[model samples]
Target: MELTKGANAALDAGDVEITVSWRATAGSADLGPSLDVCALRLGADGKVREDADLVFFNAPSSPDGSVRHIGRTPDGAGEVVTVDTTRQPADVASIVVTATIDVVTPHLTFGGLAVSARVADLATGAELARFTPPPLGPEKALVVVELYRRGGSWKIRAVGQGYASGLAGLATDYGVDVSADEDVSAPAAPLAPTAPAAPTAAVPAAAAASAADLPSTGDPRVDMRKRLDLRKKTVQAVLTKQGIPGRQARVALALDASGSMRALYRAGTVARVVERVAAVAATMDDDGTLEVWSYATEPVALPPLRVDFLADWIPLYVRMRKATTGQGGADATLARERAARAAGWPIPNWDAIGGQNEEPKVMALILEHYERLPSPPPTLVLVLTDGGLYRDKQIAELLRRTAKLPIFWQFVGIGRARYGILEKLDTLAGRVVDNAGFFAVDDLDAIDDETLYQRILGEFPAWLRAARAAGIPL
Candidate 1:
């Protein structure tokens, strides 16, 4: 169906690919505008919930994996965004397909380009709708079309909305943190490791035997099965399935305490995560204790938690604790400082270490902590975050350094915010052995234990063999 501006068409239940094509105007400048096609997954509020909701060149796929920018068309005339309505999150009400010109010259606009977009059923390869926007004026960006939820079904609309401001302006209107775009760079090739490549293929049974059967370090009275909660037991099973059964490792938990994570903390989701990861410690750690830290601008070392003390851990450390401060001036500051020190807390005036994302600082601290130990065990650091990671280069360097050590960083993205560097760990290079893995879950409370465990340990076992082969102590 050829759709005019404002026209609509019903969509079937399946993956629909939106292709946007643009060409330079006749007899224009030799250099054409750098056209970038993007898809914005909007919520019921008509705005994106987070920066991850916008799928573009930088962020190729949505966190839910429903919306994906499939790159330039086969002929290289346009870009395609595949919308899997079948997997679309309930909160996503619509996906707006937009096209923008990377302005290299002053006052560049859509008038200099001829742009059109089409939607087709990905399965059958049948064109469902096509839209040719009217001639635009000074707008540098245009919302060519939209695939939106209609009751139980889906529908497509040709929304020829123009934006005089460029991609940043248009994105800002949709609730994306455009400020992050400035610090963000296009996904680059991962750094090459200086060391020799370790055996990455699944290790033979005999080779894995030496590293198997971790010593039982916990109390002899408490049964292992009885110690772990159901969810943690599932984690243990997953570890076994991944070929690292009964392997001992020091476990650490790093929780995000940024402003954006306030909701998760308030809903007791963060506490639940602590409970779950503590199980990993129970199963793997020497002392059956989990080292804990909460971070935003800085990392706050909290009291270490054990399976037995988990019941009281959340209420005391995980839960937010507010204390009076500015109202009483110097006396208040002195009082709070003394009180915080007496309680063994890190800082005097603390708000869960809540502020902006300074991942490198906390990461450095974690690295230093383990480095100080005489002989640290193979450590599994589970960094739970809700996205907003911008220090990509620093993080890459740190991971590279960590590759030579016995530490494995398993970064779990808690929500659908832009994960930036964490989302691109697979492509990261310059490591003796790949020491990091990442996966995002939309809702922690809703995910089944089996699937969560599987994802958590997906790359760990392989890393274990590889690490040992590289002569890293485990």
Candidate 2:
């Protein structure tokens, strides 16, 4: 049935999926479309069930298992949030769903946003109802719809309510800690939408007491997907500009697991990088799984991480604090075991390898894997680190040779450490092609996925053409 403003309907469907979609053109030049799905649990009085019951991006799901916020759609196309009617907590008498303007134009109001929402039954996937709110009054936020328990039945209401105060005001109505992001900037960029707290040594304490307080709308995978989609044309355009056609390729990640980088791992920067890489791999690789390795001395191939398992990737390994550091070096054996339990994703076991910040081994393994494939696919390797690698000359020599292989290296500098050789790689001479590139960010958390992925991929197309012209096997 069509839903009009302030109209309500009894939703007899047992389990339902609600998707919100909109077509918005910003009135301000600096403004971008940044909207969010917030699920507010309410008690009998209809205020709020409790502070912890507020579900959005950071806290993706309600603890009671009733609500699940699937990642956002790209460029404000839309979003999906699921509700299992029977699973809602006993105390949650109502679930108020709101769409809020996160950080767009200062004057953006719900009335200006052409928005619509639809509810569908999960089991049969049948459309239960849909509502397209007209130009709302002057509110930055809108109470689009609400599902509540009424006389032993479930019902959906098209409230068309708008919040003048936007998300901040809506959040304040709930009990989320409304303060500042506490991320102890690593002498780096201000990482927002990710975390709070200073660089502490202990993982558990920081993640619990401070890090979780930071506001975040999307996870690493969702962030990466949106970026890749937005920049698909740009990436294609560049390749065309250089007369370089793109290819389907495998993706890998080389992580720096050294002592100095301990604080970053604890801070969850590395994990976020991995998830984004996995998302990129899903787009590039034949399979969505990515080869993950750690090197301080030598490279240890860890379990290949699939995008599906990325959510649990960090939380699962939080106990393995400093796992990549020189303290234990690299151990694919342990990483593989953990990955094996990833609920049956097609992840390969990592090979056990150990050494001290040895970058060459990572190069060797990536090349070897490509060599072994019946007909190798082109490959891109993302090297995540806070500083430069050892064996500089050997790595340079290796890159010179691999310039003839179907492999390209992108090094991301995570902290303010002098990248002795990495900074100079673009101009280094005597290669079949320029196969290596480098960019630095004080913190990955602060960088938007679009900006980060674009830069990460910027020079790759040129290198691909060079490698192809050099007669590297396709």
Who wins the TM-score comparison? 1
Tens-digit per-residue lDDT, 1-474, candidate 2: 898654568897878988887666456333355578777888854567566677788888887677888867665567788888887777777787888876646556554567789899989989999997655445677677889776467888775655565666555544344555422111110111222223324344344222223323234423333333434444444445545434467788888766677777666667667655665675566544577776665566665564433543434432223345211234642454344343232332222333246677777876787778787777888888787465788878888877777788998898787777888897889987888899998778887655666777788877777777878775
Q: After superposition, how far is residue 193 of candidate 2 from its true place, in Å?
A: 24
User: What is the C-alpha lDDT profile of model 1 across 1-474, one tens digit per residue?
Assistant: 897655567886489888999877786673545678899999965699888888998899988788899998776669989999989888888889998876555556776777888788999889988988766656777888988776477888776767666676677667777676442221111111112223244545454322112223232211222324455567778888888887778899887777777667766688667766777786777556789877788788766665543543444456333332122233444454454344333442355465787788788899999999999989988898889888999999999988999999999998888889887898898889889999998998787557766887788889989999999988
Model 1 Cα displacement at 106 (Å)?
88
Where is model 2 more than 4 Å wrong at Cα? 1-247, 317-355
| Clash pairs (backbone) in predicted model 1 | 192-430, 193-430
TM-scores of the models, in the given order?
0.48, 0.46
Model 1 is weakest, by summed lDDT over 10 consecutive residues, at 185-194
Model 1 alpha-carbon drift over 4 Å, by segment: 1-227, 320-349, 352-354
Candidate lDDT scores, in order, read 0.72, 0.64
